[model samples]
Target chain A: MISRRNWIRYSGAGVAASFIPTSHASQGRVVVIGGGFAGASVARELRRLNNALSVSLIEANAIYTACPLSNMVVGGHRKISQQQFSYAALSADGVNVIHQPAVDVDPERHLVTLRDGNTLNYEKLILAPGIDLDWQALQGYDKTAAELLPHAWKAGPQTTLLRDQLRSMREGGLVVMSVPKSPYRCPPGPYERASLIAGYLKQNNPRAKVLILDSKDSFSKKPLFLSAWQSLYGDIIEWQGESDGATVTAVNAENRTVSTDFETVQADVANIIPPQKAGKIAHLAGVTDRSGWCPIEPVTFSSTLQPDVHVIGDAAIANAMPKSAFAANAQAKLCAVQVTRLLNGESPVHGKLINTCYSLVAPDYGISVAGVYQPGEKIWTEIDGAGGVSPADASRETRAVEAAYAQRWFDNLTTQVFA
Target chain B: MIRTINRRNWLAGAGTLATLTVQPRLLAAVSEPVQSVLKRDFPTAEIQPGRVNIELPALAENGNSVRMKISVDSPMTPTDYVSFIQIIAQANPLPDVARFDLSHANGLAEVETRIRVSAEQDIVVVAGLSDGSLWSGSAHIVVTVAACLDALY
Candidate 1:
């Protein structure tokens, strides 16, 4: 799509640079909204692609924590400190990172307004704000339920809170996790959480059970996780897909009972992962469709309704890919490439992408699934047989091998997105 | 090109002057054959007659990722055991989602995991019966996001 090199090349040729601020056309200001995987990656990559191109990233949260391995943090395999990362890495790459949310995107004026009331004009704008939870969907739950039974979808404090609650659970306690319907972030995530908890239950509290009260009958990486669970935990885990009447309707946090339309479930801990939509910014910008997601052109990540604005990550509706860390990172790379090319006046072409998601079944064990994607007639198509789940009935030694590879994969992904 | 020419010539022979064209490249893009294996090598299934069971949620909230349990009522015995259990999501990016190799020593014929559902489609699980006969079952799900292998533009 838009590549940075294309911008410099084209700006120096047939066309002038876009989105200039007043007569000060000499400044190369690039403002990026959001600090998650997509935003952080683009901001860092843009600066690295061109040191002379100024870049500023605005994120509401000071720490750009990852949701990728937060399940392990919650499972108590590793401390939350393991999940904590700093923006110093990004800053070292010459990016001007700002800890604030974008309140407005005035494409017509070529400016972005932040929560702090400062307007930053930009020559290029990148929007990577993550998804927002539909807190109002459940009947008995509201913003109040989230305070008690946190979704922990976004990493950092929410993830830490869930971890603390899990650590405090009784030896024979039940953990009730509700998986919201589609279009949410990290499809295979909740299952990994259950697997990790069950892995812990296998060792510390053999009598304890993890009950997954799912909204759907299945999940991502089902075979690998199930194979791992059966081998590792035995009956330590109980799952209710749909035939078990698994639909989450409400939550009574004070009593720790999650209510579905059919019945109410009482548990020691509850993690209510609700359905989601595009970030509120998209809604406010009048960019969301009836599905509560943002639809964009399959070619460039640009908005179909708005100009000079691109939404990536969980916030954007990339319909073919699973909402996982790999997809977001992949989208960021393609978006960056497209942004650079678009700025230079060359049309972008289609290219296949690869994504692999690694989930921890235990500290020393792991599983992964991968995909190889190419353009279909209208959308991207993951080449059949190009990917599948990690082998089932894996030896513990093989699991350990997968675990090592998983760690390496995480490090490589984080580096790709930030470094 | 040959077929288009022949058809056009046939039309011309019938006194119909209409030029026809075709794109020959459209014939090569098709899905490959998917195979499911059990245990270490052989793709086998243990049939306990009517004891095979799969537990899934009735109404799935998210089709993107669903939780599932496969339980077969086969006694984990040395002579009589469920050899392998395999699942296939025909609509997912890859059809063969997961397969498990089992032996009599494992004692339980139950497995659970999270699987991706590409759309509102039926998920099939095959328990290769010990007698070369395969017992297959299916479950339908409503996937909201519909697995986006083509998700990115």
Candidate 2:
């Protein structure tokens, strides 16, 4: 006669006794900031784990445009609608989903202030505020300049803006993309974007050339990407790594010119991805370290500076885990479990974590890197003899299979987190 | 052991298990090739499936470089130790990935490495014990493409 939900709860009790809420345990309130993959997943997971606890999710946008597949939109392979999701499902799942920008947070008082001047109280605050572009990091690059030269890193209007610029440029024109240094979100994203853009130009404007000015000496999946570039796009795509004097210091939006350490190149379209840091809310809460990212206890994801507040996703400095959506989702679930255990007056336990990053060289060509990590004494460490990149001499069929699986992964992840 | 059980149960309850629907064709496509390779390589050894453990991701972001760890539950003494382990990717063009030879001096019956997976298929690990018995284990992995292009800026 038990309902499905109760049946699951009862059946799981024998194995996860610590997770089951006791009658004496008081109902607590948890407030989450930034409803991206990390925030949304934690909110829903908390609700699923214990319905008695009150959960509220604060997100700036009503519709989230995912960043994982946005490059395809820029390359004209997919529509922006496919990359967007609504929060109705999370709300229906008993989370108090608020469509408001959280402007500030007071860690001592455990309060979050929204843009419209209202404050929400919580016993525990979870911050999944992702990252923000550091406009001042690069000279001549600011909010206003972004309109002319779009970064398109956030995946909404900027994604379409960059797409429009690429579509309208004259045939045989130059497309310049500037990449920031390491510790940025998605280590292999820029290379994948460059590859997809070149794929587009190869079919539409056969004579056009795409130039990548990278700040790092090397990148993820380099050998696999380089081989694909050679066999597929050949002369259409060019990459200049850090040693090639490709560190961008400034950009003249009016002239469509990007200046590196040694030279200034004028282009028909300029895509500048600047250095980044934790979202503003994390800084206002005083949880972020001097590195511009939040430092947390590796086991519980609790902020080192503010133990009552936890940070996940790209905003937190998760040792050895790259800032990708997959990593964010994985961290969110682990963090949720710890938060639940802490609320129930139990100590947090370590969990196994894994991250797999996939990048598309062409629509049918794909590559990836996988790593299994564990919480170490002070930081997270990659398990020795586990995780690696794809082999260099794989056949064409392998690439095609990986490409299809990439789409499937996107669909599955978005559905699980935000559907 | 309790913590590991909790993690597995939570993972199942978290909706990840719902996305894992094995395609029958994928299994059918690899069974013959895998059996043929096993018979051709281990001509005299009889393979069983109990002691070996193959650890791998259920859904791989990239097939090109998937990491795998293999261990067999055997005491590493001169009288009773694991001798060698062979890895095979059922659907790969070149199915034989690697083979690691071991001895009592090695102290453990475990090996870890990164490998290339050509498709969504089973990765089989077979261990040869000094007692002339072979133990086998396999993990079904779904190797997908990368999703880095959509990173939040």
Candidate 3:
């Protein structure tokens, strides 16, 4: 059922059909690197869409912990166990699930080298490795400091670490969270984290304070988040936008202090979410740009730096779409579809993409932003009025419903990926 | 347990301290059992795994967006139609993903939607018959890569 329209167009008398790539022949090896939202979705969709294609998913960890709703974990609304998942389902479905770190990729030879000193060849390679924290952005914040001042931007041990620090601090102590510049994973995540932490401190330590030291002038869903902070948390939380000269210049993780141009502030606990770049694997594969992110063709997700290599998820520069799980999943399915057609010698057909992200300001309060995106002349663009954040003036009941919807969305999205 | 916080000054100047492991008691404070909402709601209802169908992919690449279609084999007549339906992801942070209220007007007991899963888990669907009996169906999804669990280091 694979289309061969491109073959006919490229050559007369159907002679191009013989030259069709048997190396990437149907039922050939399709290796997917990184088992995050983007990689996993592409691998599964590839297999489901074409059973003949042998799909192998390479992941480093045996178990996965989700970042979405991890704020709730910090707020004590949920536990980390609730977010953990295994690879049993994907393995049962015939996708070869390999738990190993892929060390390098030789695009020229179509070979992938693993940390175990082994190699695997593939006809097509899909890289969905997520983002990496850029330590250079903040002085004195490195791997060692991350242990003391956890970013918790990734959902794992760091999350628990941050939660524990908040729990152990003095009831009336100050908790400072620093936000970096844009083009990072989960644009609205830091604000959501701030709100949830405030919600936690509000209940347990009513006298406690939360300070948001931001590097950016503004943030995703700024108006809605700020409005919620004012009406819900009030004096307990203080946000210093970039306009206030809140750009953090240095950090003393051990002392829980962050220094901005204006002043150095000490805190009981500090969470410094660092600037990010494409995960290390993307750079190793030589698919990244000067921006430290992989650039890809909008329709195919094919890396501009390498042939037959596609990048998705937080690592790729998807113009209109924020680096989010939902966006990554959407991009993955499109990549799978296009990659399949390309394997079958057909021209790729682009389609509409959608992303919706929900952030909880309180246990029963929520807000969301959604958009339908399509390819533009140069990059991706959101359809007008198709995507926007939840209204600032939404009622309490409406917010509660949105909260329920957010949980439901999380469940549904997770089931779509893992169950 | 309290030492980590008070040692900030000492630790800051030292640059690094290897002894600051998180206290197990702290993680235990938030740890709880994964309890299913359906079992709580229908305590007396014996959910038999039959007469219901859950259509989903056997393998999910990304647990963020899995397509699922659930249906019950029902007569759909006023006397024999299904009353309500619930889809649950047993391992999700929130197990009660979605619930549907159906009536005889639907003419059929069916639903289709996309779901997110954090890991490899069961997608369970329970349908309440008009007689108050609950029939269920479930599909096992293998997720090579998880969704929601972000910040892949």
Q: Give TM per candidate.
A: 0.70, 0.70, 0.69
For residues A304-414, write the lDDT of model 1, one tens digit per residue. 667777777777766566667788778877777777667667787676777788888887888888887764543455676677777776678888988888888888887
TM-score of 3: 0.69
**Per-prediction fnat:** 0.11, 0.00, 0.00
* Cand. 1 TM to true fold: 0.70
lDDT of 3 by residue, B49-79 (tens): 5787776754433455555788899989999
What DockQ results do all the predictions give, each relative to the true complex? 0.06, 0.01, 0.01
- State the weakest 10-residue window (summed lDDT) of model 3 chain A: A4-13
lDDT of 1 at A20: 35
Q: Model 2 chain A: which ten-residue window has the lowest total lDDT?
A: A4-13
For model 2, how does the per-residue alpha-carbon lDDT over B33-139 read when each residue is reduced to its tens digit? 56567667775566666688877755443455555789899889999999999998767777789999999998988897778775556677778899988877777
Q: How much RMSD separates candidate 1 from the native structure?
A: 15.8
lDDT for every model? 0.68, 0.79, 0.77
Q: How should the candidates be ordered by TM-score, best one leading? A: 1, 2, 3
A-chain TM-score of every model: 0.90, 0.93, 0.93
What ranges in model 2 sit over 4 Å off? A1-26, B1-153
Which of the numbered candidates is closest to the native, going by highest DockQ?
Answer: 1
